[model samples]
Target: MVDYKLELIILPVSDVAAAKAFYDKLDWRLDVDIQGEGGFRAVHYTPTGSHASIIISNGLTDAAPGSTRGTYLVVDDIEVARADIASRGIEITEVFHEAQGGIPSVNKEGRTPGLAPERASYFSFAIFSDPEGNEFILQEITTRLPGRV
Candidate 1:
């Protein structure tokens, strides 16, 4: 049995410099930036405390900018994580939890007014997007369910 790890995600952006600057503002570690022949360039950044990193590159994929949505970044504390990103001048949607029926909402619809009243793990979330509108959700998860490592 081989263990597989997801180490990187490719983010599509129209302006590489602007996207690089935006991620840089988040204080993510800049791992790579290389310019190759024929206008090819690749940039890599890793968020703080994240084992997974993100790549923003030219000539990488055919995916459209801002097309990726609902990508999640799990956090131990939703408030702190939200505040940190907000303080960096990013506009984050209000913290929200799923409606009482246990079905998670899609995008902005069906979300309850505020944080999970019970502070339940994996229930609270905050939303934000990059310059090109690639959506990312910050989900609070203090404890993991079975088999989740």
Candidate 2:
């Protein structure tokens, strides 16, 4: 069987330079920035240790600016990751877990302050947003369950 690996995500941005500055502040590695003819531009960045990367570009997609939501980043330590991200001049939400052990919903109704009871893996979370309001969730998972990689 051929293996299909997820590689890059394209994010639509009204201003490429502003998006570049925002990701730069997070210290994500800057992979490339290109400006082509007819004002087309693309900037790529990858989070440290992540195989997948993202592109914030002009003339790449027709999606609205900041339309994406609920993108998640897995972490082994929620507090440490959240703290480090917050210390980088990012405004992040307090740590929260799904209520009654439910999955995190699109809205804020299911969230409860602080980590999950017993600090269970995959239950604790924190949230942050990019300059254009793209939401990202940092989920704490000390151990993976079953076949998750």
Which residue pairs of candidate 1 clash? none
Whole-model lDDT per candidate: 0.85, 0.88
Give the local distance difference test score of model 2. 0.88
Query: Model 1, stretches more than 4 Å misplaced?
Result: 101-104
C-alpha RMSD values across all candidates: 1.6, 1.2
Model 2, 1-149: lDDT tens per residue?
99899898888887889888989998999999999998788999999879999898878888898877877888989999999999999999999998978567877888899999999999999989888877888999998999988
Which pairs of residues collide in model 2? Answer: none
Worst lDDT window (10 residues) for model 2?
100-109
Model 2 stretches astray by more than 4 angstroms:
none
- Which 10-residue window of candidate 1 scores lowest in summed lDDT? 100-109
**Number of the top-ranking candidate, with lDDT as the measure:** 2
Error of 1 at 8 (Å): 0.9
Top of the candidates by TM-score: 2
TM-scores vs. true structure, each candidate: 0.92, 0.94
